[model samples]
Target: MGRRGDYKHFLPLQTRWADNDIYGHVNNVAYYGYFDTVVNEFLISQQVLDIHNGPVIGLVVETGCKYFAPLEFPQKLEGALRVAHIGNSSVRYELAIFKAGDDAPAAEGHFIHVYVDRDARKPVPLPQQFRKVLETILV
Candidate 1:
């Protein structure tokens, strides 16, 4: 489980009606989308990632999540992000989804992204600027 204090960056998430399944809760796959959003949002805001034109990009090689509570539409939500590890060519990003104002996360997860050359699709050392931005939230 993750607590509010554990993350250094946060983004307000809007729950959509379509996100709910027949179970009346946000579907399991939707949580992964939230996780991706937070990480990319951080990178974009920092001007560290160029989705279409950059020479380098990150490829997700590993990911997992644990659900602690149900999340339904029509509720305020937030996504929290932190860097758990930084290797020469990979970074482990830990993320959590919380009901707004809640102390504990409704769900938590992590994904490892290996930086790679976009053209060759080969692993590459992280750019100094990108690594510096990641270090800001390292824990």
Candidate 2:
């Protein structure tokens, strides 16, 4: 809601050549990838999420992005993250893409991840460990 500093965690990202589109700026779709990368990385680092073997997995049900500026190749960027909301089986993550060395965000967005059983794909309450980590960064 304010600046990059407002988020609880940050993950630096290296812009790949392919991230830029013909317009010479990072494509909108690529921004989502950046968002997912940071969220997943944090979960993995905390050992709350296991993509390959965990019984619970998150399924994104909603996502939206707002562009404030263009990002080009070779730019160093950071993905800032915080939890905006947490339901019984879903959590809303707020994210901002900030150009390295800048406090302002180049883009802002939110995505909702509904935790579900990996096998049945039915919504399930978030694990205690998952909820605990999310609480630390809840906005």
Candidate 3:
């Protein structure tokens, strides 16, 4: 359902041998991990999220995925991301997985992360840094 250029940000990820299932394809669950890794890597690299010390942390409250093709190990997976929606306390990240040399996404998904207080566990306004980074991908 998505094309290669649909997303603004891209992260190339190496598929581990352990990621493949008996059928020799990357398991369904691995796709979600790739999504989370790419998003967090971007946040950390941008100095927007500090997993250990930030006052606000994102909690994954919702997730969904669709597979269009099977990905085998040894193939590089490119995770593509864009902001579909952003609210005061939550942001919806749309993502797609493109296998190396593939013209379109082999898998597509999204997850909503609610920014909450690390101590109180209550939703909080999006941190200024968070908004700034997210805006780069917001469509």
User: Which candidate number would show the highest lDDT if scored against the true structure?
Assistant: 1
**Model 1 agreement with the true structure over 10-48: per-residue lDDT tens digits:** 999988998999999999999999999999999989999
* TM-score of structure candidate 2: 0.98
Candidate 3: list runs displaced more than 4 Å: none
Tens-place lDDT per residue, model 2, 1-139, is 4697789999999899999999999999999999999999999999999999999999999999999989999999999999999899999999999999788899999999999999999999988888999999998
lDDT of each: 0.96, 0.93, 0.91
Clashes of 2: 0
After superposition, candidate 1 runs with Cα above 4 Å error: none
Scored against the true structure, residue 27 in model 1 reaches a CA lDDT of 97
> What stretches of model 2 exceed 4 Å from their correct place?
none
| Residue-by-residue lDDT tens digits, candidate 3, 4-123 | 877988898989999999999999999999999988988898898999998999999999999999898899889989999999999999999998767789999999999999999999
What are the TM-scores, per candidate, against the unseen true structure?
A: 0.98, 0.98, 0.97
How big is the positional error of residue 18 in model 3, measured in Å on the Cα after superposition?
0.5
Residue 27: error of model 1 in Å?
0.4
CA RMSD of all predictions: 0.6, 0.8, 0.9
TM-score of candidate 3 relative to the true fold: 0.97
Q: Which scores higher on lDDT, 2 or 3?
A: 2
Rank order (by TM-score, best first): 1, 2, 3
Query: What C-alpha lDDT does candidate 2 achieve relative to the native structure?
Result: 0.93
The clash count of every prediction, one per candidate, is 0, 0, 0
